[model samples]
Target: MEYFALTNAWLIPLMPAIAFVLIGLFFKRWSALSACIAVFASAVSFILAIFAAIAVIGSGISVDAPFVGHVIWAEAADLHFEMGMLIDPLSVMMLFVVSLVSLLVQIYSIGYMRGDKSFGRFFAYISLFSASMLGLNISANFLQMYIFWELVGLCSYLLIGFYYQRIAAREAAKKAFITTRIGDFGLLIGILLLQTVFGTVDFLELRQLLPSYIASYGTGTLTIIGILLFIGPIGKSGQFPLHVWLPDAMEGPAPVSALIHAATMVVAGVYLVARAYFLFASVPALLEFIAWLGAFTAFFGASIAISQREIKRILAYSTISQLGYMMLALGVGSLTASLFHLFTHAFFKALLFLCAGAVMHAMNDEADIFKMGGLRKKIPIVFITMTIGVLAISGVPPFAGFFSKDEILSAALSVNTPIYIIAVITAFMTAFYMARLLFVVFFGEKTNMRLHHISCFMQIPLVLLAVLSLVSGLGGYIYDFGYWIRFGAPQPEHMDISIAVLSAVLPLLAFILAWNIYVRKKWSADCIAARMGVLYTISFHKYYIDEFYAVLCRFFIDGIGRVMYFIDIYIIGGIINVISGLVLFSSTLLGKIQTGQTQRYAAAFLCGVIILLLCGILYFNKISGITAGGGVL
Candidate 1:
């Protein structure tokens, strides 16, 4: 049975991959069939993932010894690279989360995307993304992981801009792809450096070899590698600066947003760091850097989210902020807490996005929360499900997010008080914005706009996700998530009860505060905005980060590009034109000499004869002098 499970484990990725090809090629005109194909493939993969997890658990394989199935991908110049599956607890857990969420998202997209011209195309992209994410999860080595990592990026670019005809979608896709590439370049360099120093990129091999490399070469090499490796996650997970692409990514369909933010792309970065926790552990400085960066990003993202009027954009920033929490957890040496938060966040975030999709669908594609009021009476299912999601993400009790996010805050409090403070403030903002979103979108005077009938396809996924959001937190108490996560690594420190209580209470207080402002309208938001003019402007404009990037891009495109154009057109082209002109002039002179006239030919011949006679006379004089000198000698 173990052997069979290992052999078929490859099917987890292959199923969706094959589905992607079929849906793209054969089902171009058949939306229903395409959805079935994609969803079925994902469902099968999820079942297989569950079986694989059970097998791993039943086998009782310790963390030091995971079940690794290998296939030689390449071998050259004494380097052997393998592509395989690492069926450890972590990979198995991620496999389930990614596949489950992907399956749900695909099912939700069915109703959300009905009658859309590119429905089949959307399914194809989703399936392809799922396959890439699964591949990343099960990767046995860094080389294999990087290959799938790039594939995931490509999938995101495709999905985020699913509405390719829209200029905003195209621009957002380009921004997402280009922004992430900066970090990818750094990650690639880091991978090559690791290969140079350690001569291997396999996770298990690195576990054995990194210490030796560090001892022989000192900590500097690991420091460089750690930072480089982190760049990839920073880009992938939407960490600070690199995080600018995520909110714009809302241009895609809501399901695609769910996929990117909740299940696949954004979480990949956190997973990447967790997967390579050993390297960061070796470099305390790098770990600290990761921790502080995550804390700052959490605060930064939350601040921006509070000011966002667009429903999906608010969720986008929320994902960024939650991702920062994961990163912060990792930075503070709590891999389990990071992964735990990652798992729970996936469900609630997906629920939130899907709920947004339903609302948008009913409201004739309206996305602004203020424009959408009294939706609670129109779409009660969405209202209920979305409320669950709101409560979960806000860290309210019994929801999945409460347990996971609390763990991260607890981890921060134990290690760094300043980060803990930042995290707590961010948590408060998270609740405030979500509370504002819920009240503004669902509770006000009804707009008399025509509404679409809620479809079963979309409602089903929301219901399923809502249940998960409520119960997924139970994973914390059912079994020790921290223990399962840190099975192979150093044990993580326990969080203080005081820290947990603070983490849980802050968000609740923020919710009450948000309720007072947006729900009750006790104090006008506009009045508050006027009072805090500069601060509100900064938050609303997202700290001018997007503007800064625009200016930087404009400089490169206009300023430097103009210089290059000038060089090509005038300097290089002018030199070539000058040579061509000289050649043409000399040819014209030669043409004049070769005029088709007997008199001209005769003059030319006579000139040539005179020149030849002069050369002969000088040659004869020189020869005669040598001959005379030799004869006298």
Candidate 2:
């Protein structure tokens, strides 16, 4: 039964992979057909994912021993490598989350991208993204995961730069690619170190052997490896310093934003760390780093989010901040809290981005929140759905975000008081900024433009996602998310009463304050901004991070590029030129010596032979005790 189920599960990622090739190559000119193929493929994968989840759950394979589908991939010099599909609770949960969100996004794009020129291409990229993400989720080994990891990054590059004509989109895609690569480099090094120290990269095997290896190698070695491994998640999850690329990623289409933030790309980091919880668990110091980094990032991203006016940019920062919460949960030793938040976040964040897309579609790509007003009546469904999404994200009760986020806060409070404080503050800022977005975009004065009707294609997905946002939290209470993918780690302690109370109160207070400021207009946001002038200025400019990067890029990358260019043009070029000149000179001299006469060639050959014979006689005479002048003188 497990074998049959694993075989079917293999088709989960394969279906979308086939769709990507078929649509991208054959049906590209047939936009409608291409979209149909893509959506059908994704829907099939989603169904298969559902079945896989059921199978994995019913099989009752312990986290220590996942139901792995394996085939020998390589054998070299006494080493064996196998390709594997890991169907444990964690992968199964991620499979459902990814496939569901991917299918809905594909469905939503039908309406959001109707009549676009590169519609076929868009579907192709989207399908490819889904396939890559699914592959990453079920990977049985670190190497396999890394391979799929890069595939998703490639898909992100293609999707983010879907509008190839737009310079901003192209640059954003490039930035996202390059920034993530920094972390990828670290991950690669870590993987190599693991493979060197241990012959296998299998997750299960590694977890079993890691403690022994650490005992043999000392904790310092494990700390180094853990830190290296964490780098990949940091960049992918948009943690702190590497987070700059995420906001710029909004330059892509809004659906892409939903896919990257909600289903696939950014969440990969959190999923990865959770997948390898054993490594961090062994290295206590590294875990503290993860916790502190996550806390700081949560606060950092939320701080920046509050000052942004662009709807997607606000959501982008919000994503970075939320990802921080996930990492913080992991750092606090609660995989359940982290995964729970990841699941709930997927639904609400997707809803939020899709809702934003609907508004952008109506407004002819208008993204500025301050410019939008009185849209509640015009797009009432979006208003309602987006409101729910905002509430969920702000941790309002009964919404998905509240359950997961509260759990994370509780975990933090139990492990580290500082992170707990940071998380609570971030939650406050999250609500304040989200409320600001809602009130400004859906309420207040109306913008001067004819409203576009929400298409059924778009509306269906939003409605579905909103429903999920409201109900997905039930998983935390009912399913014991921590136990589901405990991966040998102990479950987080129950939520602390004080922390839960604070969590309930913070978002509410922030929401009321936002309402008073933005909707009621009783207090000016600008006046408050002026009161907190320096901080506002800094946050508004994203702490000048982009500027700092620009300067570094200009002076450092460009400088190094210039040096390489000079070497290429002068030093290497000069060597090549000298070689060419020597060849040219010799060729010219040989050309002059060439005579189109057999007799001349024969005479030259004879003369050369006579000279050689004369030299030979002189050498013989000298060797026989004869002088060069006359054999003996």
Give the alpha carbon lDDT tens digit for every residue of 1-633 in model 2: 655766768789999999999998899889899999999999998888888777777777657667877898888888888888888888888999999999999999999989999999999999999999999998999999999999999998998888989999999999999999999999999998889877778898888898787778778877888889999998898997999899999888889999999989999999889888988889888889999999999999999999998999999999999999999998888888888999999999999999999999998898888888999989999999999999999988878998899899888888899888888889999999999999999887888899787799999999999999999986566666777767466474366677667778988899889889998989998999999989999999999999999999999999999999999999999999999999999999999879799999999999999999999998897776645555554
C-alpha lDDT of residue 518 in model 1: 81
- Kindly report which residue stretches of model 1 are placed more than 4 angstroms away from their true locations once superposed: 487-495, 579-617, 626-631
Roughly what TM-score does model 2 have, to 2 decimal places? 0.94
Model 2 residue 335 CA deviation in Å? 1.2
Task: Quote the positional error of residue 455 for candidate 2 in Å.
Answer: 1.3
lDDT of each: 0.90, 0.90
lDDT per residue for candidate 1 within 92-163, as digits (tens), equals: 889999999999999888888989998899899899999999999999888899999999999999988889
- lDDT at position 344, candidate 1: 91
Model 2 pairs whose backbones collide? 626-631, 627-631, 627-632
* Count of backbone collisions in candidate 1: 0
